[model samples]
Every structure is written in structure tokens, then in C-alpha cells.
Target chain A: MSEQGPAFDLSYVANLARLELSEEDVAMFEPQLQGILSYMEKLDAIDVSGIEPTAHANPVLNVTRPDEVCPSLPVEEALRNAPKSANDQFVVPKVVE
Target chain B: MSLASQTIKGLQTLLEKKEIQPKEIIDSVAEAAAVRDGAIGGYLGLDQELAHRDAEEISGGVLAGIPIGIKDLLNVKGQPCGCASKILSNYIAPYDATSIAKLRASGGIPFGRANMDEFAMGSSNENSSIKPVHNPWDLERIPGGSSGGSAAIVAADEAIAALGSDTGGSIRQPAAFCGCVGLKPTYGRVSRFGLTAFASSLDQIGPLTKTVEDAAILLGAISGGDKNDSTCLDESVPDYVADLQGDIKGMKLGMPKEFFGEGIDPAIRASVEEAAKQFESLGAEIVEVSLPHTEQAVAVYYIIATAEASANLARFDGVRYGYRAPDAENLGEQYAKSRAQGFGNEVKLRILLGTYVLSSGYYDAYYLRAQKLRTLIRQDFTSAFETVDAIIGPVSPIAPFKIGENASDPLAMYLADIYTISANLAGICGLSLPCGYMTPSDGQRELPIGLQILGAPFDEGKVLKLGHNFEQSTEWHQRRPSLG
Candidate 1:
């Protein structure tokens, strides 16, 4: 990191995002991402010693519903768009040894 | 005028008189789509059979017999809700979005899948993996997006009206580019239940139509409390149609100097200033105001929007739904490879940006700072609204640029949304309507210019009334592009 800004480490962020970028993708995105990050640095000029953060401006607060059991989407409908599903369950690759 | 190009109110009137049938309107839209869609590419797919089937049963509602173009992200049961991303290309919605249910309740048939930026990530439609939507005004120019197709379809008369969601100017910018009316209600004014999440804090679904009254009619149908979305306001929905008929005799409109000054093209600045004069002629007083923090809005938006987007978009992991990579040896490979292979360049980039901003150590620097600045932006609106009924400005700083001209520069593209993005940050209602035209020296066709109208939170009625008065005094709303 320098006075200009922290250098954007493409591989580190891509791994965090769970995206497998190839040489072509890296070549394409690196400079563009750098430019965007630098553009964001302009926000640092404003001094905010005691300002509160706003997640959103909508006035609504916490909402709740009754605890009654309700009918939900059928297994058949829920699994309809899955790439691989069988016996009302989604199939996936195993991660652990 | 052709039935396809007629306003929703115009068509509704004809249907009431028995001068035209419900099926005729659907057929007219289909005919228009057939003739122009090859050039416009606004729709990814149209459900003509389903639309016609619903048209048969259409009766006794404000939108009765009218077909509305559905942006691909909205879940309309049995229709493919692709979001213009390759990952969701094969996914069919199992249920209707709350807004779609309300539309159908009002007899509006959800007709087609309009293309958009994959996950609504970009300001230009070029980010769409399915296909880029072209502005109907000029074939080579880029249509503003991520709701580009929604605006283009309504402008080209392929559909009477369409629904669009705005995170940061997705709906209004495109509407300005394509010469249509786009209204983004205050956050939580409309439910986000079946609408795919982009940025939860800023996302809202609204209408793109040919006239201000048409926007009001469509807004009335989709608004109200929805139990499905907790953030959705339980407040009463006003009669926007009645509001449209009210006079705008002495309303004060704030014109922010930040929007009218440098960075905006001189020609666009002149057109917007001229539009301000027209507002005065219609008995409204224009007062100059300053939103000093306007410059930092775009910077804050990318951080906050992308941070939320990272969390929201992590659901597309190929385990439950959407495109999945085959032959992955392990779960890690499956997650990474499927996303890398299925998602487009822009979507991948935004996800990475979001992930970086929200990463452990950097969160305080990027995401937290943006939130505090967002408070400042919202306060700017709060102070401005105390003295004025609404704020007026330009939608985009320049005419729609050529395809690929600004796509490579993400910052440049994001800056184009400068005027429209602050309202989303502030969570206030904003509308973009055709104000004037720009006759470019490079092209023979005139480009449409839009003036943005901003109102206090949940104050859409006042915005509509002001737009309606300006619309009535001018002939801009009546101007249509000739596909020929």
C-alpha cells in the first residue's frame, strides 16, 4: 500500500469470490478494477469524525409473522431447476476426505 | 397511430368502448415485436401463447387486455427468470413475484423476458450475456441499463409498458436513453419478494411507460404492503391517478447546481436548463440548491452496492439451481468452476469487487466509510426537501454513447449515472421523463434528453402531478420513434 492507494490483488479477491479466473480473465479485469478502485479513493477527502452509518433509509423496522406452520414449495418444483437432483434431493460434489 | 404505439390509457379506453378486443392488443404487440425485435433485441424471449391465453380472460381492470413486458429478473411463474445471465438461462420460475401477482390481479399479463445486465450489474446493456440491447433511437448507440431492454421495448412499441428495477439508475437512465418514462418509487414502496436481489438496500421495482399517467396507473397496481418483503412499507398507497389530475400551480422545485455544472455536456446542460424554464412557464418556481456531497455519491454506491451484492449473489453456487459445471472432482472445484464458467466477465468482476470491499481487514476502509457517506447523501436530500416539493435535474450527463465506447472503462460508465444514483442512495422517489431532444452532428436522428424529478420519501403523488403538468403543456410525450 502507498499514498496512491492499496494495490488491488486480483488473485486474492477472486479466490474469496470463488471465481476461477484464467489468464485471459485476469488480463481483462486487472487494470479495469484498479481504475475503479482509484476512482473510489476520492471519497477519502471528506472528513467524517462522528457521522453514523446508514445501511438503508427505508423507515420500516423489524417485522414478524405468526408461528403457524405453512405449506411450502413442493420438492418436485423446488428441485426442478437443479442441474443434478435425485430422489427429491440435490446432488453435489464431496468436499472432505 | 398504430395500436402497438398507443399509450396504456389509450388502449384501455378503446377496450372499454368495444372498438378493439383484448386479443387485438396482444396480436398488435406481437406484430410489432416481429417487425422490430431483430434490430432492437429488446426481448430475450416472448411467451405469445401464454399472453394470448391470458388476454382471452382479461376483463374489468385498469390494465385489462394490456400486456406488460417483464424484466427477466422478475419471477413470473412458468416463465424463464434468467436475469440475462448464462447461469440462470434454463431456470423457470416456480412462482410469481409479489409485483407480478398484483399486476395480474389488475388484469395485466406478464408477456416477455426483457434482457438486462447479468444480475443488474452495469449501467449499459452491453454487460448482458444473452445479448446487448440497442437504443431504438440509434441502432449503434448503447441503451442505458441494466434495465435497457425494458426501456427499449416500451419505446419501440413492442410492449405498451414494462417493469424495471433500479439499484442505481438501472430503470431511469435507460428510460432517458430510449425516450420513455421511468419511475423508481421510494425504497420499500414496492415489494422485492420475487424480484432477484441485486443490492437489497437500494433495489426497487417500478414502471417504464410512454406517459406520466401511464406510469401512475402501473405504479398503483404494484404498490401496497406485502408480507413477503419485511422492508416493504405497510403504509397506505396513495391514489397516484388522482394526483395526476391535480394542479402544480405553485410547487417549488430545487435545481441542484452539482448536476447542472461541469462533467455534463454543454448541450445537455442547455437542454436541462431549458426544461427548467418550461417548468416555470407551467406555474412552478425553480430554486437553485446545492447537494455538496454529490461528487462522492458514485464512489459510495459501488462500495455499498457491491458489498451487499456479494452476499446476495453467493446463492448461485450450482448446488440447488441454475447452471452447473460437470466433471468437477470436488465441491471446491464445483463451486469455483461453475461460477467462472457460467457467469460473464462483468458479473465476475463485480462479485470480486464486492468480495474485496467486504474482506476482513478492508471492511472499515471501504464498506463502512461508504455507509457513513451514504448518510451524508441522504441528509443532503432531507435538507433540500424541507424547502422544495421536489428536486429536478438531468438523468444522464450526455447522449447515449456508441456500443463498446465506454464498456471497457467501468468507472466512466458508473459516472454516467451521477445524477440518478443519489436518489437511490437517499432512498427517495425519482422519475425520468422525456424533456427535449439533441440533434447530434454525427447522426441524422435526434437523441432524447430526460429531466429527472425527485420527491420526498413516499411522496410519489407530488412527483407525478408535476410531471403530468409538464407533460400536458409540451408535446414531448407524444413523440415516437418510427421503426421504419
Candidate 2:
């Protein structure tokens, strides 16, 4: 928490979130970044003794239905709603060179 | 009958008598939407053809042929689920959300999708990428968000009832602002399958209705076990409708001291106190209860919510489905450009905060500690329930602030959800119903204020009974937003 995260280098966050924040946004968000960090710092005051951490509030149990396959949306009907598609598959720009 | 005055039960009664056909109800609702929705911005999109078709198919159920609005965050098969964001502008859902399926099975007419904050992230509806939903009471004020549209539509009588999701006061706060009944069911009461995730652990699908009885009927229809969502409880969902008229006599009600303390607007505070008096008049015992951890609720909520949000939103990369930016040179750039171009400022802020807190080095000090505090907060409620059957508080510190009042300051906007979010975080059932109106000291207009009733885990019956008793004694819920 010590090292001042790069003034404009949210490239690390961008990499982690697969997001591309503009250089302008990174500059704007820099000052406010510390406020969020400080807000999280307030949690350090709470004392947790003999407390078991809970991930989900309800008791965990497997919710399974019978293994019967239900009919799916037809390919043509499903693809009809897609913005761009070809050969019954969603069309996308070429990725691999 | 005018669509505005017909409750879900009233409509069902008319339908049973064949005095009003389902088609007539659909047409009346469509007419109301056209007249009222333009001013309020309650709907993102409306499907007249599908709605009519659904109404025509209505045969028998509790809410048969009753038109309902789905929050844009929930999936409706083949409809554009914008989630009020530009990122998924053209994304159409391939499946109906589990709650929607339940509503359909129970004969609900899916009239339209309601607007919400982009991805259920903000308190005011201003965060919506598409359009801000205005309060029907005063067009200049907000209707509250991310469930703002759901609340507004129900308040304005554009829909008899609407389904909404609460991550952190998304349902209750908006319901309070719009002067309607909103319930955030016990976390696992409703399944989360196909409701677009904001904070998976905290989000619960519930209803916004004109009356507590309608809310009870809607919750009964939609809640139960779901195979698709593993987090949903397997326990039998009790007949909430049967318990709607339960005796409130001799029931113990706790009034949390912190909730009604300073910082609460005097007018709103008076409204809650008056509501407690009404409960006492109804023969329920009112006792002062203290939740010492009340001040830490907001900080604890942000940390835990953002951490879960960071993990849940990781699925929105430009991969399997949803928005993908065009003209990216590589896979990495594609993922980055798609999200960056797609998400709004608030959504990005949460994602960044979520990712930062959950990051490897800071995980223990930030995320882990927040999780530990969450347990303590839950225990605070559990211990208080030992002394009282239910806890009551002011739903929000103030009545609906003007639209742009807190938009600039994120902290001010976060504080608006202060009293309501803890119920979501603790995974308990809570409902907000109109208690009275308030006129601010600055000569600002009077708006509706709500009293929040929270019950023990899976104890919605107690909360509903208390709300029902209050509604029977007072005429607050009877007052409609002056849309004219």
C-alpha cells in the first residue's frame, strides 16, 4: 500500500480486468484512487474473534434436477437475434493471425 | 376499472368474474405506459405484441393476466437485456431468468423491461447509460436506482407489480423513493439464475408492488428451489400468502436507535416514530434495540460488494457472449477495448475497486478483513433477533433528493443506501413500505418516506404481517404519486 501506484499506469489493472482505460480516465481517476483505498482501510478497526467467515449465507447443498435434456432454442431463431452471424455461428473479427 | 386503481388481487378478482378480460388489462396498461412512461422514463423497452400474447394466454394463477415489468438486469428470452448499459446495447438474452419463468408459470404478463442503473451499481438512477428514471411525485427528483424504474412504474400505475433485484438497497431504497412496497427476500428465497450478477452473494430478486399483500403473493409465486442456481436454498418455501394476514398482536418489534439518530431528516424520523406508534396501537410490543455496528455497514458493504463484483464481472470479457468491440488487433486488445468501450463510469469504478481489493498482495488486508467483518455484522442482527421478533428502521436517511443532488459525490450517493444495505449483506428479509411524507427544512417539496421492517432469516411472514398491520391502520400506501 506504500508505493504510489503509477500516476497514469493503470496498465496493471487493465491487464487484470481485460479493460482498456483511456489515458485521460487514468489521469482523472488517480486522485480519487486513494479515497477508495482509505475507505477500505476503515475495515481494519473491526475486531473478529471466534468468528467463522461465511462465503454464502445459506447452507450449501447441491441443487440438482433430473438429467433430462430440454429442447433448446432453434439455431436459426437463436442466431436471428444476433447482431452478426454466419454459418450458424456468431460472426467475429479474425483473431489468430 | 382504470388500470391505475387495480391491484393484482383486484385484477384477479375482475378476471375471475369475467368482468375484465386479460386483453383489456393489457390494453389499459399499454395505454397507461404511453401516457405516463414518457414523463417518468420507467421503461427501457416495451413489447406490445408479446405482452398481448401473454395476456391472451392467461388462464389461472394468483397474478393471472396481471402485467408485470422486469428490471433490465434480469434476462427475458429474446429481449434486449441492456442492463441499462451501452456495452450490451444489442445483446439479446437467449433464456428467461428463473424468476421470470416462475412468474410466467403463475400467469404473469411480461409487459416490458424496466430501466436500472447500468449493471445495478448506483443509488440514483442517474448512473443508467440510457436514460434516468424520474420520480412520478416530482419529475425533477430521482425515483432511486438500480431498481428505480421498477419502483417508479409501480408507483405511477404503469404496471400493477414489477420484479426487481437488490444488491445493496437496489430494491428497498427505490421502493421507498417511489412510495411503494418493495421486499428484498431472504438471500436464497429467490434463485439468482439468469439475473445479471452485480454482487452474487448479496443480490436477491423480489417484487415492488402497490400493497404488501401483492408483494406477498408475488414472492410466493417466484421463490423456491432452482436447479440452475446452486446458491438457492433447498428448503420448502412456505405459503407466504397464507401467512399474510397473521396476527401481529403481541409480536415484539425492535426500533434500532442508530437508524433514527442524528443525520436522519426530522420529518423522516417523525414518520418512522409515528409508524412505531401505529405498531404499538396495533398491540405489537415496541422495544428499543441497538445495533452498535450500524456506522460500519456502508464501509463493510462497499468492500464485500466490490470484491464479489470483481469476481462475478470477470465473465463479461469479449469471449463467449455479449458485447465485443470491433477492430481490435489481438485477443488481449479485444477484451480490453470491448469492456472499456462498453462499461459506464460507475461500473468501471466498481470493477477497478473490486479488482484492486482482490489483487494478490492486498487480498488479506482488504478483502479478507471485510469478509471477517461481514460475519460480525450478521451476528449483530442474529443477536438482536433474540430479544425482538422484528427490527424497524428508516429506509433512507432522507426522502428522494433532487436528481443531480448526490451524483457528483460518490460518498453521498453511497450513504443514501446506509440503512437498507445491511439487510442484503446479512442475507435477511427486509421490506420498505410507505409510512408518511416529509417536507424538508429548506422549503423543498414534501416526498414519501418509508419504514423498513427486517425479520429473522427466512422470516418474511413476520415482516409482511407487520407491514400489513401498518398498512391497514394508515392510509400512506393508498396515496398515489401525483403523476397528473
Q: Score every model by TM-score.
A: 0.98, 0.95
Per-residue lDDT of B1-484 in model 1, one digit per residue for the tens? Answer: 6788888899989988999987788888889999999999999998789988888776668898889999999999999999999999899999999999999999999998998989998888999998899999998988899999999999999999999999999999999999999999999899999999999999999999999999999999999989889999887988899888867879999999899778887777888899899999988999999999999999999999989998898999899999898868888888899999889988888898899999988899899999999999999999999999999999999899888988678878888889989999999999999998887666788889988999999999999999899988888877878777
Alpha-carbon runs more than 4 Å astray in model 2: A1-9, A62-97, B442-444
> What TM value does chain A in model 2 reach?
0.72
Any idea what lDDT model 2 has?
0.85
**lDDT measured at residue B145 in model 1 versus the true structure, 0 to 100:** 95
True interface contacts reproduced by each model, as a fraction?
A: 0.90, 0.51
Highest TM-score, which number?
1
Where does model 1 exceed 4 Å of error?
A1-4
Task: Give the lDDT of residue B370 in candidate 2.
Answer: 75
Q: State residue B398's C-alpha deviation in candidate 2, in Å.
A: 1.9
How high is the TM-score of chain A in each model? 0.89, 0.72
